[model samples]
Target chain A: MYYIDDFLALLFGISLLIAFWKVRTPLFFIASGACLTIIYSITLFFISETKPVQDIIFYSMACLGCISGLLFIRVMLIRSISLHALKLSNTMTKNKKECSIEDQLTEQMTSEIGFRLDDLQQKGFATLTTDGSGQLTLTPKGRVIAQLVSRLYRAIER
Target chain B: MDTLFIVALTTCILLAPIAAEIVLKGRRLQSNVKRVAPLYIVIALCCITIGAYTHYPHPIVIVMYWCGYFLTWFGIRSHLESSILLKMLTTLQTSNLSRDELMSSYLQSYSTQSRIAELKNSGLLESKKGIISITPSGEKLLSIIDLLD
Candidate 1:
């Protein structure tokens, strides 16, 4: 049990270090988990007489750590979804021409906007034309893009 | 106190992109999901590390964390969908065509049910006597679009 605990600790420590080194934003969660661990370890080390306190600290840290781990998984899942959306958009754009405004918009969207029309459509951000054709129409929600672009233009002008 | 401070600082950093997006471009918060996931993951990972070291054995913690994460994810997804619908409607409003013409054009081009659903959801258009017209809320949202000019 001692060896296993040590191994887990080492793994977490190494992960924390890498997170810091890579400037991984997710490191914040890991760091939080580490801090909880440190607190528990310190309580166990210094408060040997206070068994109840030790237990409480141990439980609290464990709870926090588990929660953090689950959150990390969720974040990963969201990232995967976003990546999948981008990939789908890229694949859709890749098969088409790029010189026209529509193609240019699609290309700019996949490359710069990091989203795809299908994803938007599915999400209610946009919709497909009803003619059983591949035509895409921006939904009202998509109107924000024009607003966002105009804002950028205004800022640049300023 | 220390933990709270760290958490607050971290949350602020994590939310920076959201603030920037809203202020800089008036984009919906959901649009930044790809960039924001890492921050949430980091926070989650940190909690896990803390839990393991604390030696607390409770499955409920993990469940709660995941539930919260998924809730936030879905919330963002819903918001993104709404934003897209809002954008399309605003574009149609600005075009040179009449409301009937725009509706017909959109109907001819896009799925009517989805378009109507989006409009209804966004509070942009109301249906009465089988006709739809822009609502006050819709006007407000569209006003933002005009402000872009």
Candidate 2:
């Protein structure tokens, strides 16, 4: 019983780490959560000697662990996908031992955060002008997120 | 196993940040190590004190509770400091822009100067006479990442 929660938490963390790197889909996260739920239920069932309150505590902590792991993994994956730092490092490799970018992102900035707006378009945050003018309009979902982020960013800056 | 102790533990985990923030408000609290130490010490002392006081302390569960608190704090701090998504969304909030314009605007507004400053501050990259070079440590760090990826 003493070592079991430690083992279970480790198992859950490994499951989440695997689920995240396995694919881009949300299904894996859901599957990992489901697996964790099953593990928790089975473990609690076997440790039935504990009273109802203790069971509640155990389950509550297990639930928190699952949610925390899921959220943490999501944040980490998003960070990895950004890869701006990697791009900068890659750009530095061009000039042998030294380099500089004083002009256009295309010229010397390497990727220059060449993060495509198609990403936002695919996420439904931005829409292209049909004439191939490349102008973007924010979707309602995009507007909502933009508003929330603006507020949060302002608050943090303050 | 004490209900009150568990409740206190959870409450402390959640509320410690509010207390820390209040302490950090007007003064540019430089030593985050010191800021974070108090709550951690309090939690540790609570775990030990509870064991002595009630003689029914669960070490693993209490430690998990502490982990939850620390991770929660870390996640919030990380997001506030480095969330590109948040910064991007905020950039988009101001105006309707084209693909090229949007990317360039974000890069101009936040990415270039700040990233350069951060990289330099971290000692990973250095600029000498307008030429930039990665330090040996930075090269080592990138190599490790190359291996991992």
Candidate 3:
């Protein structure tokens, strides 16, 4: 039982360090959560005289749950920052009724959107390739992700 | 057996929102975490009370049980709040939205505007005569993000 307490404390302490490092990606959190679960489970199994499987499973499940919660919060904050960046990048003048006569969104929003596109490409979830008419199309990976999201949307009815 | 029962109950409590979503035919209640979280909390508390009366397990068991509940609460709240991005992704997946249209619509939403107002109120940015600018602290935050990237 004391070991379980120590395990929880250590899990949270490592999670805090990761948060401070600003590694706020969902993938990072998921990977860390899984990795830590396995590592701790093995450590506890070997270290305990009785090799309790139930304790190991319990700790692993708790770790995964807590890490997932932290990940969701972190990603939410990161997405908000993206919006804040777009807002902060706004450079509208007082006299101008619009940031640009042609652009509905401010220049900053466009640029941030472009950055997000580039980021998706860099992450290999997407790619930018111009067609014969200079139109862009999703890569195979992008198509797969898009299809998955669409299916999920239909399933959830959201 | 007591430990097993507590663990199973915690899992059920954690999964209640999903079950609620299914039972309600995917209709969310007011789209707020507060609306659904209390039901889970009440259920958890009832189980804990009954378990305590029956067994009076170690204090650590009680502490661990509540910690799990806290994690469940946080996870549920975060999931509900962060569904905005999922919604956006779903929209993008189903239909095309130009960058301008997307950002403009996002800004037009009352919640987004309120969030921006919050940033301004929190001193991360300031609005003067309709022009918004990031403060030094905001710059510091951006720099940290950049470093992380």
Interface RMSD of each: 17.7, 4.9, 7.4
User: Each candidate: fraction of true contacts kept?
Assistant: 0.01, 0.27, 0.13
Cα lDDT of model 2 by residue, A56-121, tens digit: 466556456545645654555455422345346556565464435433323433352444454677
Tens digit of per-residue lDDT, candidate 2, span B26-133: 222222435665766676577657744664444554555566556656566556555555556667677767656766776676555565665666666677677766
Q: Which scores better on DockQ, 1 or 3? A: 3
State model 1's lDDT. 0.44
Global CA lDDT computed for model 3: 0.52
After TM-score superposition, the amount by which residue B13's alpha carbon in candidate 2 deviates from its true location, in angstroms, is 3.5
lDDT of candidate 2 at residue B12, scale 0 to 100:
67
- True-vs-predicted CA distance for residue A25, candidate 1, Å: 34
List the candidate 1 regions with Cα displacement exceeding 4 Å: A1-158, B1-31, B49-55, B59-64, B67-71, B77-149
Q: How many residue pairs clash in each candidate?
A: 31, 0, 0
Q: Distance (Å) between predicted and true CA of B26, model 2?
A: 11
Better of 1 and 2 by DockQ: 2
Q: Of the candidates shown, which would achieve the greatest TM-score relative to the real structure?
A: 2
TM-score of each: 0.26, 0.66, 0.53
Model no. 2, DockQ: 0.34
Query: Which residue segments of model 3 deviate by more than 4 Å?
Result: A1-51, A81-111, A128-130, A155-158, B1-7, B10-14, B19-31, B46-149
Question: TM-score of B chain for each model?
Answer: 0.33, 0.60, 0.46
Q: Residues A12-128, candidate 1, lDDT per residue (tens digit)?
A: 445443443343455565666567456645644454332355344543454454435444443533443322323332333345423222333333333322333235557774565
> In model 2, what are the clashing residue pairs, if there are any?
none
